[model samples]
Structure formats: C-alpha cells, structure tokens
Target: MLSFSRTRSPGRNTSPLAGGMDYLEPKRKSNVLGRLILIVSLTALCITMLKNAPSFTSPTSFSRSQEGVTHVLVTGGAGYIGSHAALRLLKDSYRVTIVDNLSRGNLGAVKVLQGLFPEAGRLQFIYADLGDAKAVILHIPKILLYEVDKIFSENAFDAVMHFAAVAYVGESTLDPLKYYHNITSNTLVVLEAVARHKVKKFIYSSTCATYGEPDKMPIVEVTPQVPINPYGKAKKMAEDMILDFSKNSDMAVMILRYFNVIGSDPEGRLGEAPKPELREHGRISGACFDAARGVIPGLQVKGTDYKTGDGTCVRDYIDVTDLVDAHVKALEKAKPRNVGIYNVGTGKGRSVKEFVEACKKATGVDIQVDFLPRRPGDYAEVYSDPAKILRDLNWSARFTNLQESLEVAWKWQKSHPHGYASS
Candidate 1:
C-alpha cells in the first residue's frame, strides 16, 4: 500500500525545437521555409479549436444560499475522509451539499452522517460523477449562464473540497492511464467548474505519497516531490494544475498533503469502510479490521527487511478527525489570491508490527500474521514535520493515540460488521 499525503517533466516551458532552431539559424542562409511551416501549423490549430468550441462551452448552473448558513460543496462526501469533513462542517453551522457518484462511497455512510445531524438541516447529498460535467451540472439548480463560456458563475459556490478519485496505488501502478483519468482529468473538470463559478476557496485532498521516498525522516512542505507510483504522480499533476489555476484566478487554494490516515471517527458516527469485495488491501488498519471480523483469512505483513528499528516500514498515522479539523481551519483561512500547502500528520512514526499489536489490543482478538517479502515501492520509513500546519492553522493531532483510534475503529466494525449492510 502506498502512503497518502500523496513530477515535473524537464523543459516544459520552452519548446524542444526552439534552441535547435536558433542553433541552426546561422547554418541556414534562408529561413522562409521554417516561418511558413509555423504559420501553417498555427492556422490548422486555430481551425480545430474553433470547430470544437461549442463542446467546451457547455452551460451549467447551481445556487443555494440561506440566511444564516455558509454553503459548501464536498465532493466524495460519502467516503471515509470526506464524510468526516462534511460532518464537521455541518456541526460548525455550515450548510453542506455532498456530491458523490457512490462508486466507492456507500449510501449507508451518507445515511449515518444524516442521522448524526437530523435536526440541523445542514447536510444534503447529490449523487453525481465528478468526471461527467453534464452530470454535475444537472444536479445543480439553474439560475445563471453564458453562451459558449464554460463559466460557473451560476453555481454560487463559496468553496469546494474535492476528494472524489480512485486512491489505490497498486491499481494506479497496474494502469497509469486509469489513475490519470480518474485523478488528473477529473480534477481539471472540477477546476474548470470552480473557475467558471468564481468560487474562491478550494481545498484539495492531497496525499503524502507525493513526497515519494524522501531521504529525510520528517518531510516538510519544501521537500522535493519525486513520486514513485502512478497514484502519487496523478495527485502531483492535480496539485500542479490547481496551483497554476490559482495564479491567474481569484481562487484561494490549500493543498493538504496527508500522511497515513487511519482510524474511524472517534464518535463512531463514521469510519473507514470501503466495500469489502472492492476494497484496496494496502491499508494496515483496514487489514486489521478484516482480520478481526474474519473477513479475510488473516493479515499479511509485507516487507520485514527494512532499515527501521523493527526492520519494517514505518509511517505517521493521523486520526481522521484531526485531518478534517485541518480542512475546516484551512477553509476559514482561505482568502482571495492566496495559495497554501501544508503537511498533515502526527509528526511521529509507527512500524507495521506496532500498529498490528495496537489493533490486537483494541479488538482483544489474536491477529494472525504472515511475514512476506517487501511489496514494490514500499519505503523504509516516512513521517511528517507538521510544525507548519500547527503554527499556521493552530491545529495538531488530538486523537492520534494509536490504541484509542483502533478502539473506535473496532467499535465501528463491530456495529456495522458488513459496513452499512449491517445497519
């Protein structure tokens, strides 16, 4: 499993042929042929764009404003992290509209969230795919538009917290194109929608995998991003695009690069429960949950030959509640023309054996483990230097005591043995 808190090509700004053309200028007495070729290429490109202009300029509208509540859109709000963030938003008196296609998210998660705030009237769900522009537009209320302009002025969205994407690193590695389509391409669609609507605040759900395998123990925001997998690569591409979009627009963006996020919501209202059959098998906590329920034969601990103290991979695990707190604070701090990037973690490291032990303590069940060879792309150790976020957002991990987190997770697993189907 690749750690989350999930790449630049060289010479991207200058054309590859520009320098070569200049170098050959002295040798070539006449350059008229080159100039003609350039002109022909530009003319053809313009004609093609003109022919496809209408498809790019689809009309879409969305609007929702109440007297006393701040409106927000949380994509993928039925999933693990998104659901927690949405619940926090509603608790904080913000009116939230959750948009998820429910491909990976469970309707039961949304139902559980709604149950938490039955009287608040602050949460709503829209089932739509982020990758489909028309699907997203149809769900929003129509109140404004422009002909042939991909403007989102009618949506009236104050901020958008995007978390809708395929997050499995193994799958990403197996099919890089799928990761690109799900993570990068979908992000562009959301960006276009956000930019069109003049939505100023954007909180991106990024991963620590963007840091790849850094040489340093605690990675800072300034660390070099050398992603080793397609999942991280896809996220890095989205982060770059978001930063580029913020440069010319009024949008304020915050890229929250998360470390290993484990545990359920402390209150037991929500937890990490991906559909069992389609669940990504890389998460240690999820593996423990399955073992506790006999969902799998037992847990498999991959890689026990690392340079760490326990000769196993080490990661900083932050509670989902604390992770969502950082999001809420980032939303409050967002202002026009401002862009911020922060690492979200507990600033500590725990080995695979240690985590498994904690899970055993939490569930009071014997967890069988089979030591296996290192999985490809598994780093020896990784954590965070979260001083920046603590200093900037006045936030720190409060529910990060590993045992406490595991206990809560056990409760969720016990209560919903089949993950919402148990409801």
Candidate 2:
C-alpha cells in the first residue's frame, strides 16, 4: 500500500494529498516559464544591440577619418604576398582586417604587421581559416547587408582582397586534393562570405600558370587557359567560379594573373619568410641569397635544356610591391558588376643564368650552382603582355630590371638571415 501525505496547505475544499500536489506544481511551472521568458528576452536584446551597433570597420576620431576610406578584408594576410598586400593597405591608410589560420602563414609576419601599426582601428587581425564557415563567420564580423550607398555611408568594407591559397607547384603536383580543397573550395567559401556581407569589390591573387605551356610568348588575359598542373588547374577553377558568380551578382572582380612574384617591401619592413617547413628562399634571388649566406650548401639549377636563350627556363619575375600597387589601383577602379582580368607582370623574361648573374651582382658573391636535367612540368619560357593592364588600370611593373630587383631582395635576405627566426 502507498502512503499518502497527511499534511496539507490551508485550502477550504480539497483532499490532503491533492492539496499538497497543487501547492508544489504551480511553483515548478512558474520557475520554468520564468526561465523561458528570460532566455527569449536576452536573445532579443542581443539581436537588437547587434543591429544598432556601429560598424566594426568604423574609425575613431583620433584614428584615420572614415571619410573616403575603404575597409579591406585581406585573407591569408600572414603569408608572403598577402602580408605585403596588407602592409601596403595599411600604409595607404585603409582600415584592414587580416584573417589567417597561420597554418601555412607565419604568426611572426602578423606580429610584424601589428608592430608597424600600433594604432587600434587602422589594423586588425583575425586568426581563422577560410574553410571553417562557422569560425570565419564568428571571427570576421559581417558587414551589415545593405544597399551600396548605405554600405559606403556606414563605413563598412568596400572590398575584399583574397590571397588565401595553398600555392606550391611541386607540392600541388604531389598532393592535388589538398590544393583543390584549399584553393578552390576555400575560395568558394570566401566568395560566399563576401557576397553575404554585400562587399561589391573583390581582388583575387591569381597566377599566370593558368596559361600553362602557352603556344607563344607574352600571354594575355584572353589567352586560352590550359593549365598543366594541379596548382594551375585549381587556380583556374577558382577563376571560373568567380566569373560565374559575377554573371548573376553585382560583384566587381579583378583577377590578377601573376607570372612570378619576387622582391620584398623596399622599406625592408616586410620580406619573404615562408614557414620553416617550406624552407623556401627567394625563388631565384632567394636561392642566391641562401647560397651566398651559406644557408644551404649551394643552389641547383633544375633544368638547362629548354629552348631559351641560355637553354634554361625563362619566367617573368614581378616585384611584389609593384604587384600590390596594381591591387591598390584595382581597388580604386573596380566598378560594381564589372569584371577585370589582367596579367600582373612585366613584359619581359629572365633566364636562370641571367637571374644567377643578377643575384651575384646584387649580393657581391657568386652563388655556386649545379646544372641538372629538366624537371617534369617545366615550361621553356613564359612572359606576359601586360598591355591590357597598363591600358585599363594604368598599372605597370616598376621593378622590371632583374639586377635592381635582386639588389632590393638581397638586402632583405641578408638582414633576416634565419628568415624570421632569431638566429
């Protein structure tokens, strides 16, 4: 037999057990209802606050004025090209938010950028991967979706300079999936986020490899894209996707196809310091620096049998600063619903022997080299027309002279012997 409670509340007409149950049930219900109401009210309050808050990219009075200033989001801003771009943006007085996961980029580079601009609002860093949609959304504050006029008036981002990609030709050849996933898929995610935020302008760091083993010299923007390797294929895929996205949207895009990027910040504030694992010295200048500095035993010339002037591969090496200057010009000229494709290179080519001589002259030390047979996927010669970019953006590579560019790079390499390492 179950025992019933004899104690009861002071009720006029109710059984003792029933009265006891009635006393406790209302209190439990009230507690739950109160909690539910509190939760809903808090959520509403947060949403309201977020809706009314000032723009994340807005400037304080002491900071750079918000007038005519563009806030730029630079993905992969800790890597070599990305870092240089970020530095340029900061120097040009654009409010910049750098989003990098530091997976392939260097945290030390981010620190260098932060050190350059100790100001609070001019520069910001967000450590997040482009692939993680949720984390990226959480870390990079979205520009409130609004009309173009309102976006400019509200001082939100006017553009996105996307440089986040896994960009090694040899490595991509070995691990194609990783390149496709990081370069193509991650780029799609970035495009989606940019679209969601209503940022109209996009500057893509494309590569000239899209025109792999071209039929002729001086490849143009209209050159047929028949990429030879996975790296080039991934970049070409991204370019196609970006173009496809533009067909239906109001996004203005500038796709800068680079031949080769070399040199560093002329001011010596930034340079190429690839992650320790990459162990990448400068492409040719960097190799010379490493050899001269004795970082490696010596440099090796991969192939000398190509049908070039010196029987070595010839590439158009563009100074990184000049490349970024084009980006700045592109940002200014990018009109909504317009797409611009330009080859960001000097209309010239440098052979391996020529680059070696330039490096030697720049460093004042002869770099020992060993000639080897042609490596697979090696192109005989590749250069850019650059006439289209010159006409459109009024942009041209200023550091076309190989020796002058090498000299600037040599200075940077000599100073940063360990490549961001204290040694």
Q: Could you report the Cα RMSD, in angstroms, for every candidate shown?
A: 20.8, 6.1
* Residue pairs whose backbone atoms clash in candidate 2: 282-286
**Alpha carbon deviation, residue 213, candidate 2 (Å):** 0.9
lDDT of 1 by residue, 340-392 (tens): 89999999999999999999999998989999998766678889999999898
State the lDDT of candidate 2 residue by residue for 261-347, as single tens digits. Answer: 888888887788766566542256666777898877788888988888889999999999899999999999998899999999899
Highest TM-score: which candidate? 2
lDDT at residue 324 of model 2 (Cα atoms): 91
Give the C-alpha lDDT of model 1.
Answer: 0.82
Model 2 regions lying over 4 Å from their true place:
1-67, 132-155, 280-282
TM-score versus the correct structure, for each prediction = 0.80, 0.82
* Per-residue lDDT value at 218 in model 2: 83
Worst 10 residues of 1 by lDDT: 142-151
